[model samples]
Target: MNYWILSIEAIMNTFSIIESKSDIRFKMSLDSTSERGNILDEQSINAGDKILVFIDKPVGEIRYMLEVTGVDHTHLVLHKSYETGYGLTMRKMQQVDEETYNLLESNNHRQLHQISEASFNTLFSHMFEDFSNRYEVKTEQPVIHETKEDYVAPEKNPQDEHLPHNWIVFGAPGTGKSYQIDQQRKTYFGSNYERVTFHPNFSYGQFVGAYKPRPMKEDKSKITYDLVAGPLLRTVTKAMNHPERNYVLIIEEINRANTAAVFGDIFQLLDRNEDGKSEYNIVASEEVKEYIESQTDADLVNYEIHLPSNLYIWATMNTSDQGVFPLDSAFKRRFDFEFISINASEEKIGDIDITIKGIGTMKWNHFRRTLNDYLLQHVRNIKEDKLIGPFFIKKTDLEASDKHFQKVFQNKLLMYLAEDILKTDKTKLFKYPSFSQIVTAYIEDEENVFSDAFTEALAEQE
Candidate 1:
């Protein structure tokens, strides 16, 4: 039986056809379909006839071997190999007589078609423009580069689908744990975060919203409730106004305070599921209410509270505190705990220096080599906790005219690490001088070609 060309959709009606090739050599009209019209460009085409199929949805040209099972004035039945035949499938087809077949078969058809001059040129202009567009279109792909400066914010790619209500960051004093908190606050909370360092005697009322008693007439005149909104309540109020922003409440040295005692009723807010804005009242059982009421002459029945969605907490701790108790398992599970490891100087020292220096020089690549050399020798020491943060040497605040930078290194950075570096026995470990002394040498090391004039200015300031 002669092969016929049929669409895959024609498989409902059974008929077999020769294998069809998919490569199209001729320009095919892509607008036609079996429902609209199935007539090929040429009429009366026989089996083994090289024919083009226009595929419209994706708009592409495909070639197939055509086999005619039957024909009529309005339609023709053809078969293709990949699909089974549809018997007497209706389609508009053009007849390809022997002479017309010869004209298409010979390569000279191009020369003859080209002679159609304006008509052929117009057709090709549109075809080429379409083909060029399709060929030129580009697919998007993600690029990942391995570099020291590749810092991606956690919120930009948070582990959870939603941001955490409370977060705690803990590590050694100089491990840059607080740095992450500051950055996250800047990123998520922008200007809304309120940070406070918790101390041993810090009160629950100080952390949570509390009524501050104002001085009354003769100390017994009247009691006025001064609502002092703590970091938690302040963040809650800030987040309520700025729902788009994630308002962060940062507690530095969280272990310094009695977490359970300090949090008190606000501890209920730490439940991640509560999310701070629930309207329901948590009814305390009568027995518990009666017990609490008996102990404190206060009505302790139902507690009406609303949780805010925008409030988040970040706490930083120093693990060296033996006096501080471990966080309760219930409280710990509600938070995602990420332990910020101490610096691996090899990984951080040189890179941080280069980053700071590049900022100083305004050249992105400047100081890379110098920074790398400094860290290559110091990474092991830092990993062993023998070295303080290397960022101390690369202080960029010296260049800044703002009081903020001056205060950041002093208030935050120095308090955490200056003593650590000064205390390190570098002579016993690396046969080197003290960190500050070496830094002094570097500032005075004008003979060094890489050292900038600004170095001398900073050294003078020291």
Candidate 2:
């Protein structure tokens, strides 16, 4: 069977959805199209062909494999207006884990990828075995549930059918919290989205909307202020106007600013109803309500602000960062939290070798794993967040030579340890006349480097 990659913005964006007009992405037309039609004409995908469904935002991740049921000339939902394009009917067949999906780097470059039989068996078989026991598991069970006569079944990815509307991904620094959040919004099909980084002085007006001065077009000297929309306001405006499409609002380092103060009265809209709409609409100022209404397609009712179901709000937090605003029970309870593990990207260090002058060489992954354990074992009342992650020291630092690696150790690694971790009580861990003596001695005179504690830490295995 032929293996192909199919790019989609949403799981159910096919002409299969009733009253759906989003047909451009799923079409396989030849005469009018340029790149996409050329690909489809060459492939000539059949009913038995395999399709690896991928999200369309270039996140380089695949969730499921589906089989092409058939090629439908007419729209799947029975629309007569669209006839030039042909849509494929697909059914989810197999699934893969994120780690397994990340193994191949080729898919990162393109939305479409086709593999030969030999390439599929060599590469895909191993990855599929990591999650599911077999490369292909045949099951004919239908996933649809009948409800009403006019109800139609919408296709969703096997694993991620439902995602939390308000979610936060948290982890220690370098553990890829923001990276995780960035990848997830694509699965939600966030074509229209906004990303804002929070700082100490960020305010409600900046998060929502504010009146800003603008030079008049008629005269350069004259100026009048207008209500300018912020990230949240712009995203909400798009979501309200186009209810069919999904929108996202990303808050990077959310706790850097006071969420309670930044969100203001908008916090009341966090509680969502069964349909994913905000349970309670927060009262808005008359000016603010009028501004939002003018930007939306929906009729104005109570003149209040309510989060649309199509909008998803996500944030990332660094647990290691100091002086961050704390969230109360009420604020924290409103969202689901996902913690990224320190060992998540351990394999990314690969087989990079760092050799100390007086001591034998150790692998990058092995060194960090040993050092992290030593911090927890030897130090008193130490937190996991304080320990360095897999990406704490870049691989390039050790790729050069032993002398260059020693310089990085003395500067970045040792400096972080002295100021943040050990503080004034580093005498027991590091060996030197003073911390300043590290530059003069380059481990040439002794069997072990920095100190006995560090030497012992490096000796650890697994």
Clash count per candidate: 24, 0
Assess the local accuracy of residue 120 in candidate 1 as a C-alpha lDDT between 0 and 100: 25
Cα deviation of 82 in candidate 1 (Å)? 89
Candidate 1 per-residue C-alpha lDDT over 1-462 given as tens digits, one digit per residue, 9 for 90 to 100: 222222322111111111121122222233344443333434433334322222211111212223344443334454432211111111111121223223233421111111123422332233223333334322221122213465333244222346566677766445677777887765655555677888654554456533333334455444332333456545554555545555567888887766776665566656655444543434432332443344334464453333456666778877554456567888787677767654423244432321221224322112322333343453344432232333433446434444444355434433333334324544422123455543343234412212344344333432
Segments in model 1 whose C-alpha atoms lie over 4 Å from true places: 1-161, 213-225, 240-245, 274-302, 321-325, 344-387, 392-462
Quote the positional error of residue 321 for candidate 1 in Å: 5.0
Q: Candidate 1 lDDT (Cα, whole model)?
A: 0.42
TM-score of 2: 0.60
Give the Cα error of residue 161 in candidate 2, in Å: 1.7
Best by TM-score: 2
The estimated TM-scores of all candidates read 0.39, 0.60
**Which tens-of-lDDT digit does each residue in 1-462 have in candidate 2?**
576654545322232121111122244433323333224543455556665544433222233345555555421111111111111111111232222233232233224445555544433333333323322222221111123653332233212456777888987666777767766655555345668899765555567764333446677455444555567777887778767766678899999877886787788888987666899987675556767878766655776789998777889987667768888889999998998887777776777887665667778778777777777887898788777776666667767777788878768776777667777676555665454555445444533445676776676463
lDDT per prediction? 0.42, 0.59
